[model samples]
Structures are given as C-alpha cells and as structure tokens.
Target chain A: MIEALFAAVLGGLLLLGLHRKVIARVQQRPGPPVWQEVLHTLKFSFKSTWVPETASPGLFVGIVLVAIGIWTAALAVVLAGGSILIIFGVYMLHKIVEHGFGLSSGSPYGKFGAVRSVISAASEIPLFVSVAAIAVFTGSLAISDIVAYQAVNGPLLIIAPPAAFAMYLVILSKMPFSPFAIVEGKELVSGYKTEHFGVWRAGLEVANAIKTSVLLGLFLLLFLGPLSPFAFVVAIVILLVSLSFVCAVTPMLAPFDSVTIQALVTVVMLGYLVLLGVIP
Target chain B: MSSLGGAPWYILEFGDELVYFTPYTTTLLILALVFTVLALVSRPERQVEALFGTDAIYAKDTTVDQMRFRRFMAIACGCASMGAVVTGDLFNFTLFVALVGITNVGIVAAVKNRHVQNAAFQYGLVALTATVPLFAGAGIVAATTGTLSIVALASGTVPQAPFFARALLCLGVVGEGMAPFYAAKAEMFRAPGAPYVIMCSLSSLLIFLRVAEVVMVI
Candidate 1:
C-alpha cells in the first residue's frame, strides 16, 4: 500500500513536471514553472463556486468529492493485491462508471463526451482480452505471478509483442492526446468538466496526475519485470527516452485510423512471438 | 464452467481448469491491432452538413462534442458500487453503499431543475429510511449468528435476518439507480447525451454487484 501510494504521489508530481517541460521545449518558450499544475490545483481547491440557479443545488459540492473518490478508488484497486480477474473487473467498472457520469448530467456536452467515452472504451476491449490471454497462459492473475512468469523464462514482450503493442495504444488513448482528446478537450471547456468550478475541477487535476504515474508504473512493470523497485525507475527513464524518440519520428495519426494500425501491428507481433517461442 | 465463444473449440480444456486456445489468443491479438489502426485513422471530419445538421436542435455545438456532468455521476456511482464488490464484510459493503449514496446525493444536489430536486429528495428519504432498517436487521442477524460477515450470508452459514435488510438494500439500489436517470430526463441537462450515459452506468453497476456477490459466495 505504501509503495503504491508513494508511487502515485511522487511519480504523479514528476510526470506533471515533465509534461510541462516537454510542451515548453516543443513550443520553444521558457514555459510555466514545473510546479504550475500543483499551484493551479491548489488555487482551484480554495476558490468558491457560484452555483448556477439552473444547476442542482446539491451539486454545488458533490461532484468534487465523487471525482476524487472514484479516481482514488481506481488507483487503490490497481495497486491492491488480488487475482487478475478481480482487478481487471475493477478496472472495467471504473471505465464504465466514468461513462455514466458523462450521461447523468443534463448537459449536451456531457452527453457527447459520454458518446466518445463509449467508443474509446469499446476500443479497450481487445487490449484487455489480450491481457486475459497472458493470464490464461500463466495460470494466475496476480501481478506478482505475471512478473515471475516473465522472469523465469523471458519477458512476455519477447513472446507477446502484439500484446505489448496493443497496450501502448491503450496508454495513448487513455492519456487522450491529439486524436482521442475529443472527449475532454479545451475547445469543449474540458468536456464533462464545463459546469464544474472550484474544488470539483481540482479533483480532476489530481486524478489525472495520479493516473499518469500509475500508467508509467505499469509500463515499467511490463517491460522491466526482473528489476527491483528502484531499478524500475531506471527502466522507466529508458522507456520514456524510447517513447520520446518514437514520438519525434512518427507523424500523429487520427483516432479512427489507429484501429487499422493497431490491428496490423498485432498480427505481425503475434507471428514474431510465436516464431520466437515466447508464448507457449 | 467455461465455454468457448459460441463454439466448442477448446483453448485449455481440463477437468477443473479453463484456459484460452491459441486460436482464441490470436483472434484477440488481431482485434486489438485492428482497433488501434481504426483509432489512428478516423479523425473527426468537418463537413458543413455534418456540423450544421438539417435539424435545428443539434445544429449548435456541432464543432466539437462534449461530455456532461450527469454521465460522470453515473460513472462515479458505478465505481462506488464496484468498490462494494471488493469488500470482505457487510460493514464494508455498507460503507461502500453510503459512499455511493453520498455521491448520488451530491450529483442530485448539484444539478438544477424541479424534477431533479424532487427526485433527489425522494431518493434521499428512501435511502435514509432504508439504512436504518438495514442496520437493524444486520444487527439482529449478527446477534443470532454471532458473526457479521458478507461471506457468511453468501454461504448461507449465517442465520437469515428479518427480510428487512435485504429489502432495504434492494430499495437503496433502486433509489441510487434512479438518481442518474431522473437527472438525464431533464431538458436543461447539457453536454454528454443523457440516455446513453444512464444505460451504460446502470448496466455496469448491475454487473458489478452480481460479480461481487459471486465472490462472496465462493
């Protein structure tokens, strides 16, 4: 629990710092301070909300608590010790519930956002099924069991390249960059977040910071399983460097087109893993 | 207990164990790859007709789609409901229920409209009234069984409570479910479409609860 909490907090802050620096470098400007996100969150948390008369009076305070509660719960479930099936179910529940939030609101943007969420989630089904495949081969859903399986033979990445590639796509889609950002973008005033202000908005920012750290941690766990906790950090740095290189070399693809790209990549990777005898 | 997808092709067939077949594995991998490609290729196109549809209602906000707060409420409620599934004891489930209840209350309170307000008050009353009976019955069951556990109930090891707790729990679930639906029914509700959000969230929570019950049983 401590390890997950520590990772969530520290890793989140670091990623927040890195995200800004990278954007700044891209734009060739000094950019806001690395801690700008933290400051912004703090400011929002303290600001009072002017609840619109049209808005449910109860919502004046409820949304923030709900957002924070769900995000923290998701983070905890991922980090908790359990069977893979249970954890997977928990993750699915989180995604579905997020869609529900988009719909319950009376706003059109919220409804549209929910539609995008549905499509994004549908895309995740294949990725999750692949993860389930690994569990079938390994005979356990525990993360430790998965790590042990890779360590005993070789990393699953060597045998399940297709799975790895699919996971990479999930990482991008969930983080919501260029293409998938349609659901929650600035043009939509942060989509589902439009009516929210003060503490409620801050909940989202904190949830995002924590989520990034969790994603980075998962990346390290998948690619560098044999390493110790400290070593995982080193492995992540190397992976980030590689991701940055790829990011620079590749042109951005549209979200709709990503489906075909991912499919082809999966086919090739599966063949390679099978030929290499990485998957038994 | 395990069956392949609409076919008898076995992936890992054993007396007690069920696993995926190589063919099934390959299929999953291919599907993931396809989704990735589709995600990459389908950029939102800007057609004048698509943006400004012939209909007057959705003509505005055509430039970019948005998600609504109601949908998020449904999601949060679903999450809390799922959280209830992972707990090992009745107390924990109650706590989760309370958390979900508070979340629903919060969403209902935050949104505006007489319908929402009425729904929220009704939900609040039902929820509050039910919790008391739920606790009383649970307390009686504990007194009779000498142990209070969710698993015990699932296993049929604990003495049955005064039917009141089960009824209360069911009612609470209904009230919780309605909070999102009523909010979406309102006209002023903007952003993410309401009906879709309600459907997804309600269904997800229902499944989540069933899974959690199964876990308790086993």
Candidate 2:
C-alpha cells in the first residue's frame, strides 16, 4: 500500500510537470516552468485566506480543504487497491463538496457554476459503470487486481475494447477537454472557479492539475494495465500527446440543457451493447 | 470470491465474457460524439464565433454540466453492477441497476422542465417496463437452460440463457428504448420546463420500485 501511494505521489508530480510542458507546446507559447504547480501550492499555503463578506466563511475554508482532501483520498484509494466502489464514492463526495463551496459563494455566477457542477456529477455515472464492468470482468475491485487481471487475461481491454473506448470518453469528460469541458469552461468567466483569486485560485489550479493526473491514472489502469516504471513513464508521454491532439482538433462544447446528459449516457449504454456485445 | 483462491480477486470466473459490456460502453461513447456533432450543427444558429471559440465550447451550459454529473453517477451504478457480475448475484446487480434507474429519474425531476414532463413520464414508464421482461427472461432462461446462477452466466461457464430470459431481456430493452423523445417533453413547457422535472422525480421513485421487484427475486 505504501508503495502504491509513493508511486501515485511521484507520478502526480511528474504529471504536473508534463502538463505545463503540454500547455506550452499547444499554445505555441512559452508556459510556466515545469515545477510551477508545486511552487504555486507552497505560496498559496503561506498566504492568508480572504473570506468574502457575503460568503459562508466556515464553508469557504472547509470547501478548499474538502477539495484537497478529496483529491488526496482519490490518490489514497486508487493506491491502496480499495474497491472501485469506494474510490468512485469518494470522487463523487469531492465533486459535491466543490460544488457546495461554489454555491455558497453567493455570486450569481458562483451559484450558476454550482448548478453546473451538479450536472457534471450526474454525468459521471456511466463512466463509473464502465469501470465497474471492467472490475466485474476482472473479478476484483482492487486496482492491483485490475493490473493482475490484465497480466493474466492478456488484458481484458482487448476483449472489451468498447468499454475501454467508453472509459476514454469518461476520462475526457472528467478531464474537461474541449466539447465536454462544461464546468468552468470559460462561459462563466472560469465557471466555478471564477470568484477565486490569489492563493485560493492557485489552490484551485493545483487541484485541477491533480484531477487531470488522476484521470490519466484511471485511463492507464483500465486500458494499459500494469506497467514497469519505465513503461509507466512512456505511457504518460503518450497520454499527453493524445490529449494535446484532442485539444488541437476539437473545440469545447456549448452548454445545452442538463437533460441532454441523461440522453448522452443512455446512448453510451446502448453503444456498449451494440459494439461490445457486453450485457451488464 | 473465496472460491478462486487467495487470488479469488484475480479470477474472472463469471460465465459472461468481457465483451458483454461493450454495448453500454459503445452507447455512451457514440452518444457523446453525437452530442458534440449536434452542438457543432447548432453553431450556425448563433452569430459570430469568438477568437478562443468560447461560445462554441461552452454551448448548452446546463446540458453539459448535467451530462458530466450523469457520467459520475454511472460510475457508481456500474461499480455496483460489477458486484453482481463477479458474484453472479443477480440480486446485487438488480439493486445497483435500480439505484441508477431511480437516480436517473430523480435527476430528470430535479430539472423540473415543464416541456419535458410527458416525455419524462413516458420514458420512466418504459424503463419500468424493463423490470418485468428482465424477471420473466431470467426465469425462462433459467428454466430452459437450467442454470439459475448469475455467477455462472457471467463467467461463461453456462450456455446461453433459455428463451424466456432472453425474451424478457429483449422486451425490457425495447421498453427502455422509448424513453428519450417523451423525456424532453417537460423541458419544452416552461422557460426551463417544470412539469418534466416533477415527472422525472416521480419516475425516479417509480424506477426504484420496479428495479426492487426484480433484484429482490434474484
């Protein structure tokens, strides 16, 4: 367990550095330094938190902590080989907490962002199911078992290619790439993160970087399986390349009605049957 | 789990192959793609694209957020289903499926779109119809194929299900297919659609009841 946690933290740092470089390359401009995320976090920690007068100060402080806590918990759960069920539940809790904080801001944009966050939370269900199906096939909820299953079964992904693709889509949404980048997709002038500035803003950015890494980790576990330390590093590079390609080609999506989310999931569920012939 | 070894977790002994889940996954992936396409199609309706393409990116604000939330919820529901698939515990699978069905309805209700009320209601009714087929099919498949163990089915240890289970499953699927068009009806009514929201909530409860009936039996 300790080993897994160590790997996750180390991998997370690397992901942050990789993210900066990827952003720089995509914009065709010089970006922040690779270790910028770490420096920003340290600076934010030392600064005083400025609570908005109308905001729920108690909730405000709690919200930032909740975001950090959830991200950390996700790291822990995925590392400890906890059941996918527990991991997902914790993820949902983190999302809800973040949304609650947004709503508590009392700004119209904040409130709007909060509602949007709720919508995003709802969309995560199908993604969760796709992972669960892999667990079911692998016959273990543990992340380690998933890796082991791949080692033994020659990778369940080849057998369940459609599910893998679906998982990729889920990751895309979770990662907030273009099109599905619903929450904080610049429409609300940064969506839920709008009111935040200074240290709080930095925290939000760091948290987002953490989220991006987590999603990548999930994608690797589900599709790529167990890898040597070297392979893992290579996979990270490949993932960034793909994400950049997605960024370059696809644009962000417009916010339609929330019901469209349900329809989208239903369609995905249907596709799972048509393409994979998997009937869970 | 204990039957497979200390490595019980490593054995995917369930009768079904990994391929069984493909349909659902494909459905989600393709739908997401279709949605992106639709949004692109809608872009011409507005005036002027921005330099950052912000307008194109953040198109239908409410729908995008809601879809993201749905994906998260699906993960939870699917996790529960994994329990069912691994253990061949139809009861467990049913429970998780029910939870998802109910929650989905609740979300629709929460939206409270009047224009989509009838649609939501009809869609809810269709989902409810699946419960019966699911039960009937399971029973028939069990009787004819003479294999009652869900674990066996999942692991591919058993032959195909009997006619009944398959028939019911098909029927349930057919019923579920009718959900969408009517679902958006409530969304059309008010500025944002209140009736659809009420209906969605009502259906959530209804789905719970329906899923409960089948899952309890398994």
Candidate 3:
C-alpha cells in the first residue's frame, strides 16, 4: 500500500508536468520536460522555510499538514474502493484547505485567494449531485458496488452521461489552469499559495500531485469501470491531454464569472438529477 | 454492519435517541475533531495589508480578549457540527444543525470591525429564518412516518419521509450554511481570525454534508 502511494505521488507529479507541457506546446512554446514538477517539488523541499512574522504560526504550518493529510486520506479512500460520498466530502473539505492556506498566511493576496476559494465552493456541488445520480442508478454509494454495477451493466459514461459530464466538470475545475481554478489565478500571484513557500510549498505540491492522481483515477473508475494497470495509465494520459487542450484553448474566467459558470453547471446537473427522478 | 457507507458501527444510546457512527459519519466526526483541536491550539493570525499609496505594510493584531470569545464560539461550533454528524435522531440532527448556525454567527460576532459584524448580522438573520424550515421539516418527518429516529427511518419499517420534507430539510441546511450563496460567509472570513472564522465555514459544511445523508436515509 505504501509503495502504491509513493508511485501515485510520482506518477501524479509526472502527469502534472505533462499537463504543463501540453498547455505550452499547444500555445507554440517549447515546454519543460515531463519530470519538471517532480524536480520542482525536490527543489522546493531543499529551500529554507520559516513562519512569517505576521502569520498565525500554528495554523500557518498546521494547514499544510492538514492539506496533505486530507488528500492522503482521499487517495487511501480511492485505493480501498470506499464510499464515493467520502470522496465528495473530501473534495468539499479541500475548499476549506484552500481557505485555510490563504487566510492563515495573513497576506492580502492570500486572503483574496481564500475568499475566491470560498466563492468557488459551488464547483464541488456538482460532485455531490453526480454521486447522487450514480447512487440512483446503482442503489449504493460504495465505490466497489458502483464498479461492480458497471461491470455487469456497462460503463456509466454511457448509462448516465450527464453524471459523467458533471463529474468531468468537477475534475476540470480542479486542474491547475482550468477556467474554474480562480483560487490559483495568476492575478493573486499564485493565489492562496502566494504566501506558502519553501518546504511548505513542497508539501502542497505533494498534496496536489496525489490529488491529481486520485481525481483522474476516480473519473476512470466511475465512468469506465475497472481496467488493467497499463490501461488505467493510458486512460489517464488521454484524459489529461483532453483537459490540457481545453485549458490551453480557453483563458481563465474572472473569479465571479468562473463561479457563475460552475454554479450554472450545478443547476444543469441538478436539472439532470430531477430528470432522473432523484431528489438529491 | 461494517459496510463502507451507512452501517451503524458504534451506537451510544440515550433511550430512543442515539449517537451512531456509520463509516460516513465517522469521516465527518474525525474532521470535526481535527478542526476542533486546531482551533484550540492555533492562535489567530494578524492580517497584513499594504498601504493604498505607500510601500508600508500594516499588520492587524488580534487581542487576547478578542481570541477568547471567538475561540469559545469556534469550539462550540465544532462540538455542534460533530453532534450533527453522529446523532441518530432526525430532530436532534436538525437541532444540532441549527446550533451550528448560531455558533457560526458567534464565531465572527466578536470581531469589532463593522464589515465583519455586518456580515455576521446578515448571516444571523438568514440562519434564524432557516430554523423554521429545519424544525418544520423534522416535524413533518415525524408526523408522516410517526418516527423521528433515523435508524427506524432507514430500516424500511416505516413509510419514507415525503419528498417535500426531505427537500425542505436540505433547503434549511443550505440556508444555515449559505453555501450556494457564500458571499455573506466570505465577508465574515475577512475578519482576521483564521481558526475561529474557519469554524463558521466548517460547521455549516459539516451540517450540509450530514443533511445530505440524513435526507437520503430518512
């Protein structure tokens, strides 16, 4: 289990590197190597780090630990085929983590980033809606049950396309440069992360790497069912490339615009849920 | 009983009102514990604001007196959210949820800033208005199903709670949390006490997540 987790961290970092590369190439810029993010984490870890004078020392440091801890728990949940509702819960808590990261730092930019994170809470609502839509079809919230159901009844991607679409948007909203990631917008100078540097930033990088792996793996598991290890890797790459294309082509929306779009998506997903006759 | 979702793994009974731990509730319970501990140990940060037309940066300090009230409210909010996560009675869940809403207001009400108090007052109004639906929804569930115990409601022994009752319960939570419209909550977070202010968001989120399960189960 530990080895698998380490591999997930490594693989997830590579995927993030590839995500940057894909975006760069699409924009006609020569991109850094696919191992850039892995090296970036290593480099940040070796730098000197300390608590800022204006910061709440306990929370400034504690929030980083919490950030990594929750995502680690999330990765464990996905690995164990636990309840999908737990994943939805983790995804929502992540918004708080972002808020924590920004607010604990005491930087105006970080607070603004934190506020944007709060505003972006609407993005994850569709994830809950998607989970409910899936449970409506499978009659269970357990990941193992959903996978088993898909095995017998084909991929839910075909069976319930709207749920798949909703989950996809939820994942997209988390991607580094996607239009919905206003918390990490450039205008805020790395947004919530503006204040976290050195070892703290490295810890966040590790968490983001694991988050990337877990969300993508979850998407495949939910929509495509189980696959061989090699097939799973291939599917993730294809999905990452698709997301990168969308990221490269579209400029990030203004914060409110981004939230508005995500909320609209939630309304539409809720409409889809109503059509499916589920009141969730 | 060891199922990943809603199986009751541990139960503490108060006659018919029980505090139960399903794997789902356990996850939320742990989150509440984690944040509660953080609130206890963590000091509020001084917010740094750059001068409008100068290079000077000013840091706003949090007074010990200020921390006392917010910390107490934050811990109270945490306890309330934790109760909402584990309670087995539908009415208790609604009650716990409402308590969280009240504590959320208190978490920021200690701040002297007009902006923060303004936000808290508006949020308090929304939370107070939301209680009618929360209690009414729980009341309707008991009236129709003739039981307010979630264990009984989930056992298929009684009729399902009407769709409106469940929807109203969820609506009440949404209002208490103000999740879909977090603008008011956002303004409260600008008040400069991370640990305490977080309780406001965390409590509402916990109740929101718990209500999702409650509405589905009951």
- Predicted structure with the largest DockQ when compared to the true one: 3
1 versus 2: better DockQ goes to: 1
Best-to-worst order by DockQ is: 3, 1, 2
Pitting candidate 1 against candidate 3, the one with the higher TM-score is 3
C-alpha DockQ of every model: 0.05, 0.05, 0.65
Taken over the whole model, the C-alpha lDDT of each candidate is: 0.48, 0.49, 0.89
lDDT-based ranking: 3, 2, 1
In model 1, the runs with Cα more than 4 Å from the true position are A2-7, A26-30, A56-66, A100-107, A176-178, A240-280, B1-196, B201-218
Lowest lDDT sum, 10 consecutive residues, model 3 chain A, at: A271-280
Stretches > 4 Å off in candidate 2: A1-14, A132-136, A197-210, A257-269, A274-280, B1-218
Measured against the true structure, the TM-scores of the candidates, in listed sequence, are: 0.54, 0.58, 0.98
Q: Judged by lDDT, which candidate is best? A: 3
lDDT of 3 by residue, B1-218 (tens): 32336567899999989889877889999999999989999989999988888999889988998799889999999999999999989999898888999999988887889998998899999999999999999999989999999888888799989999998899999989997788888899899989889888888888888888887777
Give the interface RMSD of candidate 3.
Answer: 1.9
Please, what are the lDDT tens digits per residue for candidate 2 over residues A1-280?
A: 4565445555555566666567567878787777766676667767776866445444445456556555666666566555454455444444444454454455556555555654444454465457545744776556777878888777666877756766666565655444566776776777667666667766665556566667677677767788887887788778866765575466776555433664577467656654543444
Going through the candidates in the order shown, the clash numbers are: 80, 111, 0
Candidate 1 residue lDDT tens string, B1-218: 12111122444433322332222222222322222222122221111113354464322221222223444554565556544543435555555566666555554454444765675576566566656654554455566566555444544665654444554444454444432223332322232223322333433344334322332232
